[model samples]
Target: MADITTPDLPHSRHWRFSLDIEAIGWLILDRAETSTNTLSQEVLSELEQLMDPIESLAASEQMRGLVMLSDKDNGFAAGADISEFDDIAEPEVLRAALERTHRLFARLEQLSVPTAAGIHGFCLGGGLELALACHYRIAVDDDATRIGFPEVKLGIFPGFGGTGRSIRQAGPVDAMQMMLSGRNLRATQAKRIGIVDKLVRHRDTLRWAGRKAVLEKRRAKAAGLTERAAAMGPVRGYTARKMREETEKKVRPEHYPAPFALIDLFEKYGDDPLAMIGHESDAFIPLMNSDTAANLRRIFFLTEDLKKQRQRGSSFKRVHVVGAGVMGGDIAAWCALRGMAVTLQDLNMERIKPALDRARKLFQKRLKKRHLVDTAMLRLEPDPSGRGVARADVIIEAVLEDLEIKRNVFADVEEQAKPDAILATNTSSIELERIAEGLKDPGRLIGLHFFNPVAQLPLVEVVRSEHNSDEAVARGASFALAIAKSPVVVRSKPGFLVNRVLMPYMLGAVERVEKGESKELLDAAAVAFGMPMGPIELMDMVGLDVGKSVAQELGHDVPEGSQFNELVSAGKLGRKSGEGFYRWEDGKAVKGEVPEHADLQGLGRELVVPLVDATEAAVADGVVESPEKADIGVVLGTGFAPFRGGPLKARADGKV
Candidate 1:
């Protein structure tokens, strides 16, 4: 066995940072008792303490340069620990903490020996921030390695010098976007942006990263990494300000404190990397303690929790898509693109070939981006008559949302399908219970309500009808995992989850139009509130005919105010018909005044209240048993926003 464990360190503050008496300065950063290390207060404090050891080692002059490496081998640190911020007491406390972290990071940058960071795995947020302070950064070119400043999603900016450092290192535009959007960058992309000094594949990672640091330290040019920090000065300030404004566009409640706090801190010290870190303390404590922050953090944890819960230690190798329409073709493409073998089936050659063509073009685009390989072609097979169903383990049915159409198809597909193959249905405004009614293997009939344009929509509602066995739900969840879709479980109901929640909102929008509020005015209010698309525009995009049919079918069991009927009757079905609440011509929705024959523009908002109140009361009055039940219908079946928490929350808040 080889020797393990670092010498001269029982533990050093937050972690044990020690230097060995090697020819080159080798600093070992090992934080114990964690699968992935992160920069917490204790960890940051320990890092500050590491400075004393460094000065002491430097005095003896035993080493020429420093090579940074993790002793734990658990993987590079995954940025800062998010939970600590969730419970912080106050803004001042956060600011003070940031100040302390800034001081430590500043001292590390000033180290006499040129330093290099050997990074692997997730090098994100504060972790990437720390590496940027070093003179050189070398990383393993592993597909698993991820690097980025993903603080925007947290409703904050990179506080520990990441904003300025990334901007200076990658140039103003790249760094500004990195902070504002929080999108993670992989190895190749990271190298393109000048964040990575060298990216070596695994075989040569250790040797290359180590030797490169030594060579860089020996070069006179390596000393100038700090000098170039001021290269894009005016542009840097402009980009930072522009990014702040762009972020404010998305931050709700207008008066929310986080964005303004960031703008203030960056305004004061963004150009000075060392000074900027200290400013973080002020924003951190206040944002950490806010109720909005609390809610957002809870939502964040819920998202990660859902992903893990759905994954549940299971996987899928092969999946099947039935029907060759838009939904089926997209589902097949998504699955095959995500590395699962897909067998797509339709009634005949013409329909099957079209779907196959769809999947082929989708993968070809992926291939162009190097996101897919040749083997992906072999994984996707289209059949006119369910040719490959026997080899498929999961079959997603995307036939039209007609009861007879689906049940009839399932009856024959059932005979040809494998015993354990999961049967997933992509039916909108249809009850999962009724679809499972006539199946011999009803236990396998699970609902997978993927939104239209399957490849783009992030949500995937997994519906488990009463007849569906737990195994079927689990298998469907596994298939979603294999395809990398965000999955949520929902109850079996018409318009199962998302659609159920949306019906109320659409009804409210139409009611507003009836009540003298301009449709455009109401749409403006929705935009100001942070919806991806306004209700009226969305209704038009969905088409009046389809919207009317779905509303009539779904609203039949609920209260009145079926809003789409009049619009459909007047031949205004939305984008499909080129006219709706607004007229569409030349591929744009030109805002229109209330129609002459359909004038409800003088009614009161009471009309709007009735639809929302009736919906909430319907839930309480046995229309839906509970908030959870009604919510499932809204979320999965209806396409409601997940961040809102559900219809019950919206109802209780008088926002329904």
Candidate 2:
């Protein structure tokens, strides 16, 4: 594999052309301005210009075939630059931009010679659309290679020819599921779904292999008969209806218009690629201008900005988790998954095995890559004696939330670990300052709070105590990011940020239940307001006993004789006991009685107002530095409706 750059061919900062041995042109995409390539306007213009000469050559029978590859370390392209979307305020301008992009993609599709997209890393949204225009596509087979149209996440569907091309290539039903859910497919899955024509074993060899494959110009097999049957005519309508029903169960059509519009587009225009793409732009316009879109876009920027955040810390090469409970075990597992050496310390091997088992299951469920799982498992070392602290650069204590127990654990950890090793507590509710009180080198002690089901949730609250030095806090932040969790640096206080803001909401919700209001009604209200789960349902998942403990610790004013107290007294500790406000069966909540005619909108307000108030108070009290942190905390931590953009954004939009 070699790179050839010369003045004889056209070149741009984002794209360039090189001739392979077979005279096949490799249009390499490597945006000069950013680490990740995005289809910015400037990039689009350059691509358009490059195509002019390519088209002329194609007409003269000089070009053989084109293989598109990325010169970036990895990644074809993320998507179109979303920041540019904000500028297209008018429908006419948005339509014009969409048309221009479609024209460019169409030009690529009409290329006289065979075209193949060589994809690695992330080929998403516009990037996937670009790849679909190629006659064939070869993708690297790895966990890192993600291919999808995730524009729905930003409150818009793929405006480029993604919708039409995906339906035509893969079929309508599968296409709807991909676009509406915004779920990315791995290379193998992409191939199975008829999105990828060939799978490459290595990233470095993709260009050479793609050029060879395109030079052969083998006609890729069409979608299987079953797949085609599932996507067209009456069968397609049934599939679309089912998809819409499932979507409605989770998402309200009024709040989120993209998914419904996407469903409509595929259902109405699956056969006509031209009409399908035209409707895509029509459907995307209203959603892009909606307040929901703006708020979701803000979240997109926040998460993107978070990825670029770097901090100084001792190399977070090794981690020691002291305590083998759910939180501790999962944190240890997640660290190992990210390729960090982890030592999980518990009281005994009996306790340690469960944590390891939990981690092993999580790894198997996500990667399905045996070698990667084995590598992750190898990185995790179970120690019953807590001796691994000495070898760790970071020591996290995930013991019980009791102040005395935590203090004792911290003292033990501080004594056993190296002085420079960052000490962290995964205490969700306790004040970090109090936990670190009287400990030697308290500066090394910080809060590294991991949410439940650690492997799935992305937020990790990096709590900063008053004694925490910038370096210590930075190290904690760095470690959180290292584990693929978004870190929200917060001040030390009871309940910290996420739990602090959540206390009032939970207190109010349980209080309502105690007042004899229907459990179903309260939970329904939360779901109606866009919460991933109802407040009562969330409490049940967290364990009713745990919720009461947090409420007391945070001084939340739950009324006496509340359902929370009653449930604990009766030993109905939520999902564990299988009996709380709702009966549990097979890991699902079998809801009890629902009110016949309750003021649901008013109830939603009742559940939401307290969260908004608490978040505002937290921001004002300096517990959370800004509204952005508060937004991230609720969205990532508490499963706050991302479409609503956190409690504050909802309040600003008058939805709260």
Candidate 3:
């Protein structure tokens, strides 16, 4: 190895330039005042300034190659700074900014010296676009190394020449799917898909790999012949049509127009890379200004805000869940998956086996590596004897929702649990104070209410009662964060926040169903209104028996001889029982067609008004700390239409 030479360029704030004796110039991105690097306007401006020095070095013929990497430990860059998006109210301003980025990246791409991106951690969105501009992308093959264009998640597609370059490198179908879905690909997956040129197993070797690739003039993998053929006019049109159809099934064109716009762009210009690159801004600027984009960006920030609520000093490692039912089992599995040592207790191993089976499936899906999956699985133990209580940092009782059973379970837990261990209940509707009765130290008891399908939902209402110490509440919220859940601190009230706000909306749907409105029409209306699932389908998924129990606990008016009671009595429990308001097959609702001439007008508003009202009432009643917390709870906990922001936000915006 030869000695390195430092460049005496005008002082750059965000980028550092150095030239090795081998003449491999290194441009390290080290955005100041941030733990993670984002391509903010200031950072980009500094990058553009540094480009003059880069061009000077290349023009002098001293720079043999250029290697770009990040100085941040977490990732290369998290894409363009999303905070900057909020201030750009005009399309022309956004378009001008996009053009600046394009010109900068184009200069990098057209550099005479070979360029390589030494990627580690997350190389996402604009970061990925920057890498795509490079001659080669050498990625570190680690869990943190994810590569993708994720701008679609913000309701916009990439505008900095990514649309054309990604298609050229990975082919049209793969590129379109990547942009349309906004899904990140792991390092190995990126390499396999031709988005990445090389993968090194360790981060220390990333620069070495990039330096070698750049010095050797290593060519990136080109789109395969089949992929190239798919980009032809007729083939591209067929592919785009199929993509549009699939996208429509998941989201409507009116609700999410970015994906549709991308499809249109690709279909029109898939064969012409320069044309696609030139036209990307035309498509991107409009979507960036859409209401859906604004709302989705708000949601992105809301989630970021929720992340800040994680208690600073608190840490929870061992979790003990005392139930092998759906909620308990799934909760335990998720805890284990998030790197906690979890013990799931039940009556016997027979009851525990199913939970383990579900955990195995979840592990396989998430932790793709066999060793990783095995490691996660090993963290979860089946403790039918309830012995884990003594060692757990947090012991959650997810037994039957019955108050007496919960009380009895806690009384025993209090006897065996460690003195400082946080005690919690997974009860959706049961009041924490009532469940805290008979506990020796009631102040230690808090509510960590996880929603159903525990692995999927993000919100965990950390219910704080009058008796709970603030420290205990903070620790409870911390534990939720430890398991990768958003914690909404709520006053311990009936049905807490999410379920309480949700019950009225769900019950209203039931009343309408009983009033001769078609179940399919009711659900379709809500789906059109932006709810993930219809109220009727959601009810079936929640289980008729459990829904009735929560509704009754909340003191809702469930008249005798109602359809809800009739279904429960007839053993048509719901998706669990394979029957309810709708039939269930392979875990999906089987719905019949809506009757002709059935009034569907204002049905969505009619169903959601109660939910919005309940959210406002909860905020007013102090069930949650603020209207923002109420919105976060409802949006995250219930999957309230994210594009509407939340029920409260929708109501505030007068969308309701």
In the order shown, the candidates' Cα RMSDs to the true structure are 5.1, 1.9, 1.5
Off-target runs (Cα >4 Å) in candidate 2 are 1-11, 312-314, 557-561
Give the per-residue lDDT digits (tens) of candidate 1, residues 544-649: 6666667777763223344456677778888868888878888678875533323222232222343345446546544344665454444333433334444455
**Candidate 3, position 404, lDDT:** 96
Per-prediction TM-score to the true structure, in the order listed: 0.83, 0.96, 0.98
TM-score winner among the candidates? 3
Which parts of model 3 are misplaced by more than 4 Å? Answer: 1-5, 596-601
What 10-residue stretch in candidate 3 is worst by lDDT?
Answer: 594-603
Question: Candidate 3 at 234: error in angstroms?
Answer: 1.5
Q: Model 3: which residue pairs collide?
A: none
Per-residue CA lDDT of model 3 for 42-118, tens digit only, reads 98898888888788888888898899999999999889999999786488788889899999999999888899998
TM-score between candidate 2 and the true structure: 0.96
Which candidate has the top score in lDDT? 3
Give the TM-score (vs. native) of candidate 3: 0.98
State the lDDT at 188 in candidate 1.
80
